[model samples]
Structure formats: C-alpha cells, structure tokens
Target: MTPHSIVPRYRCWSKKLKTTLYTYPENWRAFKAQIAAQYSGARLKVASSAPAFTFGQTNRTPAFLNNFPLGKVPAFQGDDGFCLFESNAIAHYLSNEALRGSSPQAQSQVIQWVSFADSEIIPPASAWVFPTLGIMQFNKQATEQAKEEIKKVLSVLNQHLNTRTFLVGERVSLADISVACSMLWLYKQVLEPSFRQPYPNVTRWFQTCVNQPQFKAVLGEVKLCEKMAQFDPKKFADMQPKKDTATKKDTPPKKEKAAKEASKPQEKKEKKKEEKKAAPAVEEMDECEAALASEPKAKDPFAHLPKSPFVLDEFKRKYSNEDTLTVAVPHFWEHFDKEGYSIWYGEYKYPEELTMTFMSCNLIMGMFQRLDKLRKNGFASVILFGGNNDSSISGIWVFRGQDLAFTLSDDWQIDYESYSWRKLDPDTEETKTMVKEYFAWEGEFKHVGKPFNTGKCFK
Candidate 1:
C-alpha cells in the first residue's frame, strides 16, 4: 500500500495556535484555523506565530523552513516522514473522513463545490482585496476591474446559495469548510456593505458557517474592520527608494513640459492613422502549418507523438485516429497521490484538428479541472496545438517525478518514450500565453472556436 497518513495521525511536529483560528486577521491565520479544525483529532506538538506573517516577508526563519522549504505556512509534516504543500490538499488529508462524503453522489458534489469555490471565488476575491488592503499595490483602474469581476463571481455564488443551504449536501462537509475558510479570509475586509446588500444569501451562508460550534471553537468573535478604500501602486514602488524619489521628482516636470510642447489636437488624427498602419500579429497557426511541411519538432505539448511508459505512438498505432480521439482514456483507478497526477486531452472532432480559440477553451477547462481538491498534488496540464483545422493536438500531461505525474510513471519510461512529448512548465507566463494563443486562433475553421464544453472523467 502507498504511504498514507490519516488525519488523526498527521501533524507530528507542529502545534496548533487556536486564538487566531478562522478569523481573517490574515490569510495564514484563516488557513491555520481550518487545518487545526480539520485535524483537531490529532495531537499538535509545537506552536507557531499566526496572522502576523506577511507574504514575501516574515515566516522565513530556520524553524519554519524545517517544515516547508517554501516557507509557506499551513504546511504539515507527518510522523511518517511525509510532507506536502498546497493548503487544500493538506486540509483534505487531515479531514479524510469528513471530506470523502458518505455516498458516491455526495462525494462528487463535494469535490465539485470545493473546486467551484477555489477557482471561482478565490481568484477574484484575492485580486479585488489585496490591492485595497495595501498587500498588493495596484492602479485604480486595475483595482476597479478586479472588484467588478469579483462582484460578478460573488453574484453567481450568491445565486447558487439561494437554493442550497450549504455548498454541497445538507450537512456541512469539507467543501463548506475549505470554501468558508477561503471566503472568511476577505469577508471582513473586502466584502463591503454595498456588495453584501445585494447578495444576502451569500452573507447569510457565510455568517451561519462562522456561527457553527466547530467553527467558533477554532475561531472566536469575528471583527468588523474597515479596509483601505483605494490602492496606489506608486506607494509600493516608492517604498524601496527615498533618493530615487528625488531623482524621479526632477524628471516628470521636464517630461510634462516636453509632452505639452509636442502635443496638439491635430496629432490625435495622426495617432489614429498610425494605429491603423500598425502591423498585425504574426499568425502562429500559419507558422505551424508551414513548419509541418518539415518534420515537426516535439515542442508542442498537444502534438501526438510517442513518449516512454505511456507510448503515444503505440496507443495511436493500436487505435485509429478516429478511435483514439473519441475513446475515453483509462484511469489509474485509485485517486491521485503524492507520487503523481493525471491529464485528459481531446481533439476537435469534425475538423480533425483544433482552432486556437477552442484549443484555449479546452486548456482553461483542463486547468480548472486540475484545480479540483482531489487533484491537488500536482500542477495543471499544458494544452497547445499542432496547427489549424488541418491538424491539432491535446494530451493529459504531467512532469516526471511530480506528485501526481510521478505515480502515473512506469519507472521503465518505455511507453512514454514512444510519444512525442515535451516538458511543460506549470508556473511560466509562456504557458498562459500559449493557452491564450490557442483561444485567439482564428481561421477558415469557425466551429473549432466555440466556447469550451466540459466532460466528466472518473478515476
């Protein structure tokens, strides 16, 4: 059996700090609260500071590094020598029984809502509040955009909560616990009066969760605090320099004078003409098609080629393109573990390829799927294309030796070597850029550009 630690047996070394639990004094404090409650059955060994450790600062002492190399809090080390990052995964492992659910449908619903909470709620919430709180310094326009997007997502969640009392089944589950903790991070500081006024259901649900006995046991009285109304990016930019500020102060006035002397209303006409004359973006699909004339390199993650262990060529040769594209790929049967992860790919059916637009939509959906709590051990997949409708590619990809991907590896590397596989980065800007490229691809093919359509695959 694979090495696994139940919630009761986890938390070998760290001690729980109860005073700051679940209260959004800070992100770490809120997360600590959830982890402590989830594994309340376990005996904690040591205590650490809470709510005071700021990101990119503090929490980097030698004591902290012994647990998580990244110095990220909410990380745990088990008596069995297992350690891991990512809060959702740690919390799930700790609350093993409460998280899995009592029934199959209930389990699926739990995972679904947990995922919905993470992807839909957390992103916009962070984007909207961080800048306002001075944690992140963002421009006014950028801050406003983030707030608006957050409001839209909150509206969606509010509507969903209108009928359901909890996120998943009637009783509270890990879905509610994890999601409520995430929401509580900003509930006091970010969810301003006006936004809460319209989303009464969300407000009520949040309040009820906080009032629960278990919740209150870990987190005491909630505080009503006002956060900064606006953020100035220049504030952070200015934080690093005093002398540099003097130098910059000397330059803007001269630039303003120069700009005033060079500008006129008539120049607006010339600027518009110049904008029209700008060259269009070089078409990437055209490049791919042109490149395909020669032997294509295995750089594209979507390209159908053979790699070791999971042999793409063998699978392709074993089944015709039509069959391979349509058939559901097999699963590991057991859920993903620290040893590895999984990815699922699909090609556009009729065109026998994918357009950039649909290709991006597919990648986005895959990204969201990987965000599921059950799939938390590894990073998300990379989706790319071979060419336009004439040809395209898609695959479930994982880096070798990664928690999720490592488990899926055969050690022999035989099957994977048969496929044209390229290593992909989970954290690079290029990855997102490639996804956007796929989504923005326009061509003779129209249907391949449709919005993403999601599918269900059980392992």
Candidate 2:
C-alpha cells in the first residue's frame, strides 16, 4: 500500500472530505499530512508520480504554480479547491482536534514544538544525513558541526521526553508527530547505537512514536541505523553528470565530415555565449550549486549602470574586519553617494508563515547566492528576528541603481517578490539607525520588538 493510503478508520470527526497531496515518494514532509490523515482519517490521497504528478515537471506547470505560488511540495488541495503549501501548514490542516491539541494552550504548545522540530532538528540532521544518503556532498567541518548541533537537539528532547511520552500534554498530537518525523532520517542514517546511546529518552520517545499504528501505516517499519553510514565516493560520483556512455559511431563519410566541420566556428561561438547566459541558471540547480558557483564569472548585470563612488568591496571588508558601529558605519556614511547608490528596506510579506529560523535564514542565504552576478553592484544585511512561529525577516539593501536591482535580471527574481521592498532615504536618521542595527547585528528595533535571532550578509 502507498504511504498515504487512507487509514481503515473512516469514522472521521469532521464531515467526510476529499483532498490530494502532491510530493515525491517517501517524502517526510508529505508524510506529516499523510500520517495525520491516518489518525484523523481525512482521506488525504497522494499523487507522487506519472499522470497525477511528477516531481520537477508537474510542480513547474502554471496550473500548480497558480495554486501554490512557490511551486514547492508537499502542496495540498482540497476537493473544494482550497489550496495550501508549506508542509507544516498542510499537516496542521489535516490534523484532527485531538491531534492539534485538547485546549488553546495545548494548541499553542503543540505548534511551538512543531516549530521546534523544523527550526532545531531538521537543519543539522539534513546536513549530516543527506551526505550519507548520497543526496549531497559532505564537508568534514559541516558534518562535525551538524553532529554537535544534533547532540544538542537530542539533549533538549531527551530532557523533555524523560517524564513524558508525548511532546505536549498527555497523548499524541501534531507536536509529537512532527518531532518524530523530523528525527526519522537521523535515526535511519547516522544516529547509530553508540552515537545515539546518550539520548536514551529521545530514542525511547522516537521508538514509541514510530511504533504507533498510525505512524507504522504511513512510514512502515523504520529501521534504525545499525552502523553509522559514511558518504561513498562511488555513489557521489555516480550522481554527477555523466557523458553519453554509448559508443561513438564510426567516423562519418568525407562529405558528411566536411559539412559538420563547416558549422564548427559558429557552433563554438554560440556555445561560448550560451555558457555565459546560463551562468545564473546554476542558482536553480541545487544547494551545492551555490558553492560550485562560488566565483561564477557571469556577465555583470550592472554593466549598464554608471560606476558608483561608494565602493561595496571596501565597505564589506570594513564590516568584516573592524567594529561595525565605529568603522563600517562611518565608512558607509563617509562614502555614501546620494545619487550613485540607493538604499532599500525589505521585509518578508508573510511573517506569519515563517516557522523555521534556519529556513528563514536560508531564504536570505539563497537570495544572496542567486544574486552572485549582482555582487559588483549590491550589498544587503538580511536579518531574521524573534523565534519560531513569531519571527520576521527584513533586510537593508544598497544597490547601484535607483530602482530595485532584482528587476534587472530574471535569474534574480526567484526570492525577491516574496518580500515587500521600499526604497529608503539614506540621509534620514531613521535609515542610519536601521543601518547600524542591521550592520552591527546589535541594538533594539521597535519593528521586531528586540534583536535579531540570526542574520546573513550579501557582500
């Protein structure tokens, strides 16, 4: 049976409902809604392949994007045409009152832990586990850092689960389900016996959650990691792009060879130009694409704009090496070009939707990475403030032109529209104070109520 096949218990508390979920097979994000449906009996049908859905192809279609603006799964659509994206939101919608919480405080607590699962557990887990599964390449420092963060998360969960079977209240709720699902790959990939032994409480809680009939029906029997898995060079190599392995055909006849040779110069010239234009497409490739594009020598997007006296590189160095409030702020204002550069303030339009601190930070990081070609012309200090479920992301950007720089290139458009951008006047004390807070990563902001939780810089 499919992971999302409806549970036998059809005595759903709500009216009989029909809905479809789109995702790839065995995707833990989709599993949240599926497993919740197992308990709530919501009849959450899944379409993961072929005619109903295909990962990259179906998701990119205009029809899908119309319903799900981000084109991300696991997207959900009710038979009534209600649409939802973001796995957590979709899962919450499918969960029953019992699974959601017994009371208001319980509901808040449940969502809190759910946010905890996303913000705390998943980032480090993926960093360590993806490499082991050959889904990503590994770096020793990153792996070690992931291990430490995992240990810290497990310790927190261990203490919390020591006296209780579930994350919130007395019984299974979205909190327990979300946390267990978040840890699923960790248990399956790298948290072997010895490594996991220190967090017996977390292990016990995980086992208890997974063994439930609801989880079992959706996830099957999850096998714990027997021996810690390591990245295999062979598997990683195999995932890399391979040339046409079919044997080359024999040499063509003299006439055919001459015809092909005659087309070579233009073909080579066109191919070279194609590579230059395609440089920014790497942003859409994968997470590692950003790393691979570390020094992508693309055509400068700001080439049409006149040179600015405000040197972005020198300011970046000043911010990096010296005190931000003293050196960087002074350097910025001293060289501030009212006509040559423009300041803009941007905030995520969907603050209520941001549940993961790391995920929020990644939005900043991803935008920075994708804007690689814009580096010669722009700088931004994007910040994520407050904690999970109650956070907001805002940034201060300096661009070479008066208008929004993202508008200059289609490749840079992926993340810009998600934010509401406003041009800021650099001369105002308000703008200078905002710049200091964001640049120095200090001081209070009346907007967010306090300091930022994390921040990223696009230099």
**TM-score, one value per model:** 0.45, 0.62
RMSD of each: 19.2, 9.7
**lDDT by residue for model 2 (1-459), tens:** 432332234346483668999986677878888988888878788997679986656776788999997666789998899999888998899988888887899999998898888767876777678767655555454467679988989999899888987788766789988999888888987899999999988887788778878999999998898999998767555444333433335545786678679989989999898688666443223333323333234455666878778887788667655667778899999998888889999988998888856677666655775665565577877778887678888878998988999988766899899999989988789999999887766788877774567443222
The digit string of per-residue lDDT tens for model 1 on 44-162 reads: 33233344443323334565566566444455555565665566666655554545466888888777766766655665565555555433334333345456766776788789899
Evaluate model 1: give its TM-score: 0.45
Off by over 4 Å in 2: 1-11, 243-359, 365-412, 416-459
**Which lDDT value does model 2 have at 54?**
68
lDDT of 2 at 236: 52
In Å, residue 260's CA in model 1 sits off its true spot by 43
What is residue 390's positional error in candidate 1, in angstroms? Answer: 17
Report every candidate's CA lDDT. Answer: 0.45, 0.76
Off by over 4 Å in 1: 1-25, 29-40, 45-47, 50-71, 224-228, 232-459
Q: Cα lDDT of model 1 overall?
A: 0.45
